[model samples]
Target: MSLLNEKVISSASEQTQAVLSFVRAWLRGEETFEIHTSGSTGAPKRIWLTRSQMEASAQATAAALGLEVGMNALVCLPVQYIAGRMMLVRGLVLGLNLIVVEPSSDPLAALPADLSVDFVSFVPLQMKTLLDVALVADDDQLSSEARARALAYRRRLEAMRAILVGGGPISPGLEAQIRQIAAPAYHTYGMTETATHVALRRLNGPQASDRFVPLPGVETGVDERGCLHVRGTMTGGALLQTNDLVALQPDGSFIWVGRWDNVINSGGVKVHVEQVEATIETLAAEQPELGLARRRFFIAGLPDERLGQRVVLVVEGAPLAEDQEAQLLRALIRALPRHHAPRHIQYIDRFAETPTGKIERSSTLKLLE
Candidate 1:
């Protein structure tokens, strides 16, 4: 019997048929596959990836993380996207046992209590959700069953050889929680173009870092505008230019700054929206009473008659009271440069999100209209 005929695939839910479909195609030696980009920044588009390119990417990941054949790997992300597709490719190319589950905010919730997975990947939201449940405080109000489940999940997490977190940014608060877990977690940096992640940043332990180190065989450079340029086996020896601005390090590793397209020129001062969002997140972590950090928000530029584009803070949730909003504004103004401070705060019941769960800033802004 072939691997696809295994009990796992036969017993899988209908949601996991996509995983079975992809594996079947790979086993048949399909040469090219179509992948869709996560349109967090712009419109989503389709790109073609060769089987050789995906195999190379999978091999690089296996070597970087010391993955071996027969180890159980979990596939819990959307199969239509590259992150999830690459996870499937890695399993097929490396001869690993795959545990397929429908994508959710908490992928591990569906697993059996005794099941152990050696490798897994998650979006930031999923990672945060898992950590939140696993790290629930002892004294917190919760039923005995809930606490037991939390403990079980924590054990499952700690047993993993590697945990790859990508698809979005990991906030400071979430990073702190990740440190408490024993599992070796890494923040991956890459996109559909590079076949998931080309670089990774350690999220915990002594080796934890803010900079992303390129995997073996990958090269990094910056263009004149400071945007990142990637090349190596993953790109098939062709240089791939990205709009992501980064502070290139003396070594091959680099620190991701923000996107060039996300720059806001407010009254002549160029403000990076990511920097502003990061600052707010940090401030929220430092000063929890401000109530800014708990909410999901993004900085955007709106048309302005005088400044050409005015910076504004777009938040997801109910509107704050007059005094509370005022206090939040004061905190932001104190921490940010005068021009970087958001001129106004806009509230929406919910923010738009891409299929991969990234905040759709462009589409979310349209909600204000």
Candidate 2:
């Protein structure tokens, strides 16, 4: 039976079959399911989650986002992951009409010309890709059909009620582009353990913010190490400790700093790798000619004789020219502390990524060997 319209269909694509299989299982009252983490920080591990937990998550999201029954919810992420699975759960639990599509760099390209969904989620890369297509300049060389498709995608996006971007950080350049769009977009923060995002920060419109506000029934706290602690109905009332460093606000909203494990100690000076990366992103956004924002990159620490560990910038693809490298370093030096500036810049043909498309920092660094 097709879960889309409740019509039994004779054939289905592999991705559609996977979606239906999960929906059927859920409808038949499946209790507990095993899901894997994205392995962005370390190795991917399987964890068990109860049906009640997933339901709580979905309901909380619906309440927070004002999702109602009969709304069209797009499920374009890989269903094997928590983010995708929760989309299906929302559809089944809240009676939303599921618009299923196989995951891709541009999922909206697969939708029908006039189709408009009320809710959807994307990784930062996918949102960036969609924005690129939607904002394609008229003077840019392209076929008439390509231009028509771009227009269709823009209309579909503008008609959406809410857009959720998660699974990774949104670059400053991309966030600036998001502000130009009419859709209500949000940046989400959560992990596999929480069944998806437990908090959301508006990325566009007047309500946009840097802090992530927790959904109803979710409570957040900071540990002794300044990492985050999450406790809520979705967590089954047990607190879940995380390695993410954050500044918990007095109002309960919090600002994400970086991962505790990704901190670099160079010459006894602690530097947050994400903070350096954020600075680079801002620089790239402000000055696009540097071309840093167009590439995939990360900041890491390497063993050093005197400093114990030295911060280095690892970028994907070809190395920058000598002059360009010097300019980037000068910019970093002007923007960051002396020790926070990358001591060296390294390049790789491609970055290692988790199945869910997050950069595998540790594994990718090993590629330099």
Candidate 3:
């Protein structure tokens, strides 16, 4: 075989090397392999997964999406993360022609204009970047040359049959933009423990669902704490209880409530951080002072002498001025019920995020300490 046929990738980064090593090992009949969790809620840890498990996951995903052999898939996420790694697994097992690209906030920028991408996966950050670029393309104020490049980006996205957005929350603004795309964009829900997503909520189209419905062969319900639990072939039939709170419906679909860890028991009232954060997202788009449309924020619990724990709002970026703070507080109070109101406000120069782009609510709040 020629040197090129030897399957050597020269000048590749360490991450790409790791990806190749793992995939090669699996292809070589390796049974069990260790993978790390992104650890958005806790310390990172390694766990073993089998080739059979990954293959089963890939088949499920392919079946769910109606992916055929030799279809094209673009992979732009870090190969280390589960979402990114699964894209590779899907390519190998589902016989996709994988077009791998370096991790970026704007991976589409590197693609060929005429490339036919059937499916693609991105975090909310990447989606936001693409949406922002698409907006610029439609703006008549831009130079013709600039608009042409941006139009190419938008066209590439519209050409995809499916787009999967996960790894973090999709803001309302991004979701609205996704609706305008011709492709059916979906919000995926799952973690490394589940070998990627076991359920999907369509973000666009007439069949768009408010609840996350599990893929075939997956079952979902809530544990005693109202946290989500999975029992299915995807989970190896072992019940995998998650920290995510959800309203598990009788129809086997689930409405994600929030995270139990971020819930605050303030004066015996239960306050969900995720719910408040969703409200904040809406306000960010409406109010100029909050600027949360581009900024990030989360609700946290702080110890209080009387209430035991008080709901606190933690915003990303420099601290707000007294007037700005007051405006934010008023907006938040108006939207949230009395018990759900944040008792305190804090700011971080930058919010801590997991490698996969999930906001580390607890650790980010710790920065204020």
lDDT of 2 by residue, 192-308 (tens): 889898899999898999999999999999999999999988898999999999999997899999999989999999999988898899997788777686788889999999999
Candidate 1 vs candidate 3, lDDT winner: 1
The candidate that achieves the highest lDDT relative to the unseen native structure: 1
- RMSD (Cα, Å) for all candidates, in order, is 2.1, 2.3, 2.7
Candidate with best TM-score: 1
Candidate 1 structure quality by residue, lDDT tens digits, 184-207: 999999988888899999999888
The TM-scores, one per candidate, come to 0.95, 0.94, 0.94
Candidate 3: tens digits of C-alpha lDDT, residues 250-326: 98899988878878899999988778888888888888766566777788788899999988888888778888788
Predicted structure 3, TM vs. truth = 0.94
By TM-score, the better pick of 1 and 3 is 1
